[model samples]
Target chain A: MAENTAYDRVKAARANNRPTGKDYINALVDNFLELHGDRRFGDDPAIVGGVGWLGGVAVTVIAIEKGRGAKDRLTRNFGAPNPEGYRKALRLMKQAEKFRRPVVCFVDTSGAYCGIEAEERGQGQAIAENLMEMMTLRTPIISVLVGEGGSGGALALAVADEVWMLENSIYSVISPEGCASILWKDSGKAADAAQSLKLTAQDALDMGIIERVLPEKEMGKEGFYSVLRAELCAKIEELEILPLPELTEMRYRRFRALGAQQLAGE
Target chain B: MPFIDFFNFQPKNELEKGGRQSAPIAQDDNEPAKTCPNCHRQIPLSQLWGNDHCCTNCDYHFRMNSRQRVSFMTDSGSFTELYAGLCADDFLRFPGYPKKLETTRNASRETEAVICGTAKIDGRECCLFVMEPYFMMGSMGVAVGEKITRIFEYAAENSLPVVGCTVSGGARMQEGMLSLMQMAKVSGAVKRHSDAGLLYITLITDPTTGGVTASFAMEGDIILAEPGATIGFAGARVIEQTTRKKLPQGFQTSEFLLSHGFVDAIVPRAQQRKTIGSLLKLHSGGAENG
Candidate 1:
C-alpha cells in the first residue's frame, strides 16, 4: 500500500476500492439524518449532508459522495457535484453556524460536473458562495480529504478551520491528465504531470496547504474510525473554546499566510 | 506547421469573434490590421486601440492587457500600481514550468498574471485589480493570488471600494493546490472588505472561468460583464464532451449570464467607466465612505 511515486499516490488515491466520502460518513458519524436540496434547485445526491453525532456531540456532516458500482456511480454523478450540491453544502454550513454546532466535511471528488446543466445552474457561483461563507462561518469546522481532492469542488467544502488529508489522498489544482494535455498536449504523459503537480498528501503538507496527514493504518476498519472520531471531537472542542472572532481571525490568517513566503525573486 | 494548425484558421476562443478577441496579427507591418473574428473586418491597430480595442464595425470587445485596461478605464492620472514586485516561483519545480514562466514573462512583459492597484473611475477613488490576458492568459497562480489578497486587504484597511476586472483562464496549474488555495485566501480578504460595508464590483471580461469565477469573480456585491465574453464554471468544450450534446446558443456568454441573472448587466467596454463610476457614487453613502 506504499505509494512510491506521485503518480502511484494518484492511482491509490483514486482507487475504486478506496474509501469514498460516504464510507467515511457512515463510519465516522452516528445517527446521521440525511438532509436534502438547495431550496433554489433540486437536491443533488453527489453531496450527502445532515446533522449527525460525533462522539455524542451533534455535528453537521457533509460529504461529496461517489457511490460504488456502476449504477451507484451513475446516480451519484461519479462524485462530480453539480451546483445544487455545493449550494446544499452551503445551506447546511450556514445552518450549522446558526445553531452553534460544529461541522465536519469529507471531501472526495474528481471535480465539479462538466455538463451543460451544471453550468446553466451557476456552478461557479455556488462554489464561490461556499468559499466566502465558510470563511466567516461562526462555528467550528474541520474538513478531511478522505479521497481525491479535485480543485474547486473539494475546496468548496474545505475552507475549514483545519483541513486533514488521508495519507494516500492527493489534492491538486488540475487533474494529471488535464495538466498533461494542457502542458504537453498529450494525456499519456499524466504520470509525469502528476509528479510535477505535487499532489500527494506529503507534498501538500510540505507546502502548508493542509494541516495534518491522517494515517491510513487500519483504514476502513472500526479502529480507524474510532481514532478519527476521537481526534475530530477533541479538535472541535479545542476550537469551540476560542472566542468567535479569534477563531475566525485565525482561520483567515491560516489561509492569508499560505504561499506568502515564495515569489520574492524579481 | 502542424496539420491541425493548418485547418485551425478560426479563432481558438471567443477572444476573437464570438464576442471577445485575442488572435495575433502582423505587428511588423507599418499598418498592422487586426481581423475581427466576429465581423471579419480588418481594423488598423492604432484605430482599434483608439476605439478602445473594440472592433470598429461590430463592436466586439478585444482582449486588453491590464495596463491598457487601466488606462482606458481609469482617470487620466489616478492609477497607482500595488504589488508589482510580487512574482511567481516554480516552487513545485514542475517540468517546463520555470522555463514557461521565463518565456511568458518575456512574452507578456509582465511579472505576474494580474496587476493590482488603486485607481479612480470618473473621479471616484477605488482599488482595482485587472487580470492581464497577455500573461499566461491571466491564470491565477500563487503570486497572482497573493497580489489579489493584498489588494483586498489594502482596500479594506483604507475603506475603499474595489473594482476588479477578471480575464483569466482560471487557477494556474503549475502552482498546484497552492494556486487553488488562492481562491480561499482571496475570498477571505474579499469577505473582510465586504464586511467593512464597502462596495465591491467585479468586472468580468473575456474568458473568466474556473477557480477565479468560483471565488472573487462571483463574490462581488454587483457583478458586471462585457458583452459576448465567455464566462462560466466549466469550459464550453468540456461541457460539450461530457454531455455529448450541442450546447445551447449563447451558452456562457455575458448576455447569457445576464439573462440567467448571474450578471447585473452586460456593459460594453466603452460604457464601463461611466457605469462603474455611477455605481460607485450611488454606493458611496455616508455609512460606506465614513
Candidate 2:
C-alpha cells in the first residue's frame, strides 16, 4: 500500500469540492458584494474581487479561484487569469483605496494561462498594471495562500501587508514537480523536490519570508476555514486602527524590507 | 635503424624541445584574446567585446558575461551596481554545491549569479539587470530575485527604461522554492516597471530556459535573443522524450524561436550593443544616437 500523507488523506476525507473560492467567500466573509469587469473590456472569471466584511471591518477581497469540475474549470480558466483578470483586480484595488478599506486577497492558481487568447488580450500588460496599482494602493492589504500560489498570477494579488499561508498550502514560482522536471531532467524527482522546495508554510515562515503560518491538527477542512477566518479577523482588527496614509506607507515599507535579509551566513 | 630516420635528418625530439622551453610563449596571447574555432586564427576580441562578445573571424557568436555586456551596451562607465550584497546560501547541504559555489565565487568575483545596476544607454538612463551564467549557472535564487526586483523598483522610482539580459539554467534547486519564488518576485517587478509606462527590454542569451524563460524572459516590451542561443522552457530532451521523436536540429535555437514569432529578433552578438542602444533611444525618445 502507498503511504498516505495527512494533507492528501484529509482532502480525500472531506470530499468538499466547492466550485470556486467565490463560493467559499460568499459563505464565509460577511456582507459580501461582487464587482463587475474592467471598464475597458469584458469581465474575466479567473479573478473575482469586491468589498466584504471580515469580522465587521470592511475589506476589499480579491481571489484567484479554480473551478472544481470540468464545466466550472473551463469557466474559471483553471484559475489561470488573462489580462482582464488582473485589470479587474486593479480596478477593485484602486476603488478599495478610494474608500479607505483594507484589502484581503486569496491566492490559488497554477499560473496565468498563456494561451493565444490571453496573450493577444495583453495578459502581460494586465498583470503589470495590477502590480503597479497594488504597490501604490493606499490601504493595508493581506494575502492568504489558501492553496497553490503560482508565479505572476498569484503575485498579482499576493503583494500585501501580511501574507498568511495554510499548513498544507504551497507557494512557488512554479510547482515543485515542474522544478524537478526542469532541473534534474526527470519528473520523478518530485518527491526529492518537496524536501528541497521549502514550499510548505512552516518553511516559508521560518525563512521570514511570510508573516504567519496557520496550524492544522485534528480538524480538517473546517479547521482550515476557522483558522483563516480567525486570522483574517484578528489581522483586520489590528490593521483597521492605522490611518490611511500610515497604512499605505507601512505597506510600502513592508514590501521594501522583504528579501532584505543577508544570505551569506544564513 | 629506425623508421623515423628513413626520410628526415632531424630527430622528432626537436619538436618536443620547442614545446618544453620558453614557457610556451603564454599560448599566443597575441591572437587578440579570441579566434575563430574553425579557422584557427585571431579574430579581434577587443572589437568583438566592444561589439558584443562575437568572434570577428567568422562571426562565430559567443555569450557575453553580464559585466562585459553591461559595459559594451551601456554608455561609458555609467553603471552603479544595485543590491550588490544579495546572495544565496547552501540550504540543502547539496553535494559538491558548496565547493562549486566557492569556485564560481572566486572565479567570477561576484556575490550572486545576477547583477543589477543603473546605467545610461544612448543617452537614455535605464535600470539594468544581467544574470551571469558563470556564477552557479546564473541560477535564480533568493538573492537573484531580490536584486532583480529591487532594480525594477529602482527603475520605477526613477521612471527609467529597464533592460534585463536573462540567461539562466533555471531556479536553483538547492535553495528550493525560495529560488522559485524569484519568478514571481522578478515578474512582479517587471510588471510594475512596465505598467509605469517605463520601457523594459528583455534580452535572452544562450540557454535561457525553465522558470526564467516562462516569466520575465518572455515578458518585455521588446524581446530579443542572441544568434545561435538555445532559448526554451522545457529542454530539448524533455520535449523529445514526450514526443518520442528526435527534435529537429536547432529547435530551441534563437533562429527557430525568432522564426516561430516567439522571439522578436535574432541579433548577432556583434550588433547587440548597437541594437539595444538604438532601441532604448527610439522607445524613450532620448537623443537619437549617443
Task: Give Cα-based local distance difference scores for all models.
Answer: 0.91, 0.71
| Deviation from native of the Cα of residue B235 in model 1, angstroms | 1.3
True contacts kept of each: 0.88, 0.20
Question: Candidate 1: what lDDT?
Answer: 0.91
lDDT by residue (B215-264, candidate 1, tens digit) is 99999999999989999998888788788999999899998888888999
lDDT of 1 at B150: 90
lDDT of 2 by residue, B1-290 (tens): 68886666655564545755534333355655666664676666566665456665666667667888788878898998877877766765654567878888999998788888888876667888999988877888778878888888888998888889989987676675566556656666776677678888888887787667756787788889887887765556655544466666666778877776667887776577778878877887545443
RMSD per model, one decimal: 9.6, 7.0
Top DockQ hit:
1
At residue A1, candidate 2 shows an lDDT of: 9
List, residue by residue over A177-242, the lDDT tens digit for candidate 2.
666776686767765555566566776787666898765452236655666778788887787788
Give the clashing residue pairs of candidate 1, or none: B15-B20, B15-B21, B15-B22, B16-B21, B17-B38
iRMSD (Å) of candidate 1? 1.2
Model 1 chain B worst lDDT window (10 residues) = B20-29
